[model samples]
Target: MEIKFGDAKYYAYTGTHDPASDLESVVFVHGAAMDHTVWAHQSRYFAYHGYNVFAVDLPAHQFSRGELLLSIERMAAWLNQVIDQTVGTAFHIVGHSMGALIALEAAANFNHPDAGLNSLSLIGFSYPMSVTPQLMDAAQHNPSEAYSMMTQWSHASAIGGEPVPGFWSAGMQLSMMENSTAGSVHTDLIACDNYAGGEAAFVKVTCPILFLSGMRDKMAPAKLAQAEADKNNNAAIVLLPDCGHSIMSESPDGVLNELKRFIGARK
Candidate 1:
């Protein structure tokens, strides 16, 4: 689906399901240099199972058109605007990696009392997600190398252990990053590296939260995510064994089942 926010057009994959007022809504936000397609496995399931899904492509990424929102705060604010215009009702938000930080900030500062935030699910996330200098440099000057490094590090095994039979998880991830608009990886990495408000935001969020981490994640370690979840009264953490930062690909069923339990319980 397409909507205009100011002069720029924003795009979201709705699993080919048209939203209705009676249906509950859920929005899925992707990690850096990724798009709505990352949520392909989960979004369609939710959409067909009575929820309205908005798997969004952030501005300047994939199908969305606009200058990149250069910081987590700006991305969160823009996300809120998108939510207000699209869902405009009680909803759940699911975010991964860099998108998780955006979801954290948005849920913390959520001002829509009428359109409540039912729940938040953060996957493969960490507070103050630091980007390595080597990765940042590669993203800026040698994007292919950056993609290679990220793809290698994102999964538990570099060879083949994808949840989907015969599907090349690492290849897909690399292709997605390679296809991103120029400078988007560096822009996203800068946003993640510079953001410092996650701890504060976690304290402010009142709704139930799910911290879904991968046990073998080298990018944002599960320990960091657990530490943040520890501070929240209404939060739970689930660690997926033998998985890495790209939990959605390596453990799609695990991710889906946990989300169903978390979001379905609230409903």
Candidate 2:
């Protein structure tokens, strides 16, 4: 479904099998250069099992139309606008990678008072999400090379394991990056590198927070996420073995099971 938020058209996959009313809304935010399709399995599963799912395409990414927001704070604000325009109230939220950082900031600085958040799930995240200078330079000066480096680091192997069988997952990631605007990945990496609000955010989060970390993730490792998870009283951490940073794809069933249990308990 498409919804107008200012001049941009935001696309969300509402459950194809269910009605759009009386069900609690769950918004899924994708990582940098990625669209709502990353949550393909989880979103539909929740919607089919009785929930209103909003797996969103952020501005300037695949389906959403607008200039890229450039910073985590701005993206978080835009996400708030998305929630206000669509669900208009209390909702659960899930985010991956860069999206997880955005969700953390949003939960810390929630704008809606009367209709507060229910719970938050963050996948593949780390506080002060530092990026290597070599990668940053590649993203800025040589995007194609940066994309290549990203693909190399994203998957467990060159062929990847069963995220979307019969297709090259690493190649798929490279293709997906092409859908983003020029320098979008660079901007996202910069935003993640500059963000220092995780410590402040976790302390203020009043609702439940679940962190899913991949044991084999080369990008954002399990220990980094676990350290952040320890800061919050309501936070709990889960580690998935034999999984890479692309937990949603690398370990789709594991992610869904964790989400099912986390989201299910609140409902």
Off by over 4 Å in 2: 17-19, 163-167
Per lDDT, the best of the predicted structures is 1
TM-score of each predicted structure versus truth: 0.98, 0.93
- Give the backbone clash total of model 1: 0
Q: Which tens-of-lDDT digit does each residue in 1-267 have in candidate 1? A: 997879999999998877877777899999999999989889989999988899999999999999988999999999988888765357899999999999999898876645788999999999779999999999999999999999998999988776777998889999999999999999999999999998789878888999999999999999999998888889999999999999998999999999999999987
- lDDT of each candidate versus the true structure: 0.91, 0.83
Model 2: lDDT of residue 108: 79
Candidate 1 to truth, TM: 0.98
Model 1, residue pairs in steric clash: none
Q: Could you tell me how far off, in angstroms, the CA of residue 253 lies in candidate 1 after the best superposition?
A: 0.7
Off by over 4 Å in 1: none
